[model samples]
Target: MSGERRESGDVRGILHPGEQARHRRLTRLTVGPALSAFADRYWVVRWDLRGRPAYRAEVLSFPCVNVTFERSDLRTGGFVNGVCTTKYVRELSGEGETFGIRFTPGGFGAFTGMDVGVLRDDSAPLAEVLPAAAGLAERVLAEPSDERRCGLIEEFFAGRGRAGDPHFALVSRIVTAMAEDPDLTRVDQVTARFGVPVRTLQRLFRRYVGAGPKWVLCRFRLQDAADRLARGDRVDLAELATDLGYFDQAHFTREFTAEIGMAPSEYARAASPGQSVAR
Candidate 1:
């Protein structure tokens, strides 16, 4: 599975064309057994760039947390990454490998034993979050084979007891609906259709998903816009803005630039086939 496509099937909103090949080498697999109840998939990324200069891999993050084993120049180890509500960028140098368990929206609530919202835009050492499993990172990363690492993570989560909650399913439904429906770009659309009151929606998202429903809706909208532009579709800013529920083109450009790190027109040009981000 290409890293450019999230396990949720959303195309990554930010892609550095120079790094597309390496990203495609990523391995992603769905979880089996009860762990599947909590996670979307397990992913492994290994790259060996002995003579090549370092590259920065960027992706507009999805609204889910990850339990990961990674040895990097910066991280040097593993971490429990909370849901990131902004663009996520990782600079890559030398050779490194990472294995991650990508959770469904709100799926992390069970393992945390607390409101998942607190973890939004943050990451903690596994030891800190799950003291009993402080050593799991080293143990997992010790294995060179990604297949073994997958088993290790699966076994670890399987024994973690049943951390199931109805809220997990509820959150999944809410996020899935937003991702699937382009027309569902507004909070009121979700409120009126899903029957979740604004206050309740805000509280649940902050607790389970770590972002407000409005943020999640906008996130998906941006994802859609990015995917379309990446396909080389010539888009009109005003029309796109209206479709995305922005009041006007200026508002749309501001929000898209803030979230995606480039104006839509610029991103579209940079992502064209056979093009790469300028060095």
Candidate 2:
């Protein structure tokens, strides 16, 4: 499956895990991070299969909300469709079967006046949220008009206000920095930069992000490396290991495989042009 583009109405799609031939589609007005053009006019759909040893035979249905943090679970079943203002990072297993449809970043701004975040780790009840989102997905898949779609999203967030308690502004700053540049900074460095104690910083991360500073940083760094590989950037895996704060090439590969469920070379091949893998 090399370089074959599929056309489905106004959506153009691509599949990921080229070798396995899994069925996941990404439909968006544009491909990259720039979302200025579609501000107040679009939304995104994502079906993440981040964790699952093999393809599972369950279909997930859930309500849509905005997600701002990275999720690192080996998920198998679920479908996500909604508008979000934050970045998403996930690790997939079980053949990497998932689909996504993204609206322009600015497209949903008018609708979701407030930002939303959803986390469904082992602690949360996936069954409840998945069903709610599934109902919304049925409406979205019906091919509603742009204005109607935006209105539905707006109502969804309006009903669900902020999902959790608000942390201090300092915590927000730290999380944003980790999301933006995971490798350039460290937990000790964050404390030093903000003049806070390490324990205090760790507490902030745990309370707000559900993970410690080091775990968040490593996840983002792996995402950065994955993005580079997806876009066909060639770098010495060994050098990338050192630059991204890994112990060595072997260490990097091990971490990458554990998180991404595939070796770097395998991912690269799957993402190559004409391959079925999603970018």
Candidate 3:
């Protein structure tokens, strides 16, 4: 988002399609090839609305982790965010900026000593993880430009002598499969396909991903629903529900409304050209 290498599907799984327009500009910079093994991208978000209303953005987060620095407070240092199982909601006000490192799925296991499960849906101050990191936020935010900000984070992770989980590659493969395959709507499907026992799959996800297999499957499927809705594609509630492996249309509607904070029809209307939806 900072550099010139923007791709077509940079954040397809995180932000709902067509939803980025509601906020101030959010951009991502590709990591130097050195950190590509673990980090997916470096994201920068800036908003300057001192005289205007606040903005809010919502999404069902992917099962990934991030190390984030917010300029609003320097004493808090920075935070290492773990995978979130629930929907994500952020309300922004005033003028501020943040730099974030979104780790590839299961890629953060090593950095946090695989305390992944404890960090589920939570954040730990970077100072708590490594005392030497106490000044990281202040140092990074002091940079004059996004490019230099990302460079600071990149250099930190690139030089850190940490070891990743042995299952990182395996988990990455499985997660990639879940994101790519539409028929993968059940944990059982993953187990049967991968020849991994249900218990093993559960442990891998809990320890490395900070979420269970079922949650990942459901979240990714819901992402598909959001993608279709945001794109203005004609969607039949019943058929779409079945396509997502829901038991029935009513079941889909209830869960979708609960997780997305709106009915599917309302989400469609909000995602239409020039319309904005925030939760």
Q: Report per-prediction Cα RMSD to one decimal.
A: 4.0, 10.2, 3.6
Task: Arrange candidates, best lDDT first.
Answer: 3, 1, 2
Best by lDDT: 3
Model 3, total clashes: 4
User: Candidate 3 lDDT, tens digit per residue, 1-279?
Assistant: 245443345454544545554456677788775567887888776767688787676767778888888874223358888887777877667777777888888878855456588889899988787677878888987888778777776676666646655677788889999988888888888999998999999999888889998888888888888776676556677888887888887888888888888897787787755444331
Question: What lDDT, from 0 to 1, does candidate 3 have?
Answer: 0.76
lDDT score, candidate 1? 0.75
Give the range of the ten consecutive residues with the poorest summed lDDT in model 1: 1-10
TM-score, ranked from best to worst: 3, 1, 2
lDDT of 2 by residue, 159-188 (tens): 432222334346656656666564554778
- Would you give me the overall lDDT of model 2? 0.44
Score candidate 1 by TM-score against the native.
Answer: 0.87
Q: lDDT of model 2 at residue 65?
A: 26
Q: What TM-score, to 2 decimals, does candidate 2 have?
A: 0.53
lDDT values for all models: 0.75, 0.44, 0.76
Alpha-carbon TM-score of each model against the true structure: 0.87, 0.53, 0.88
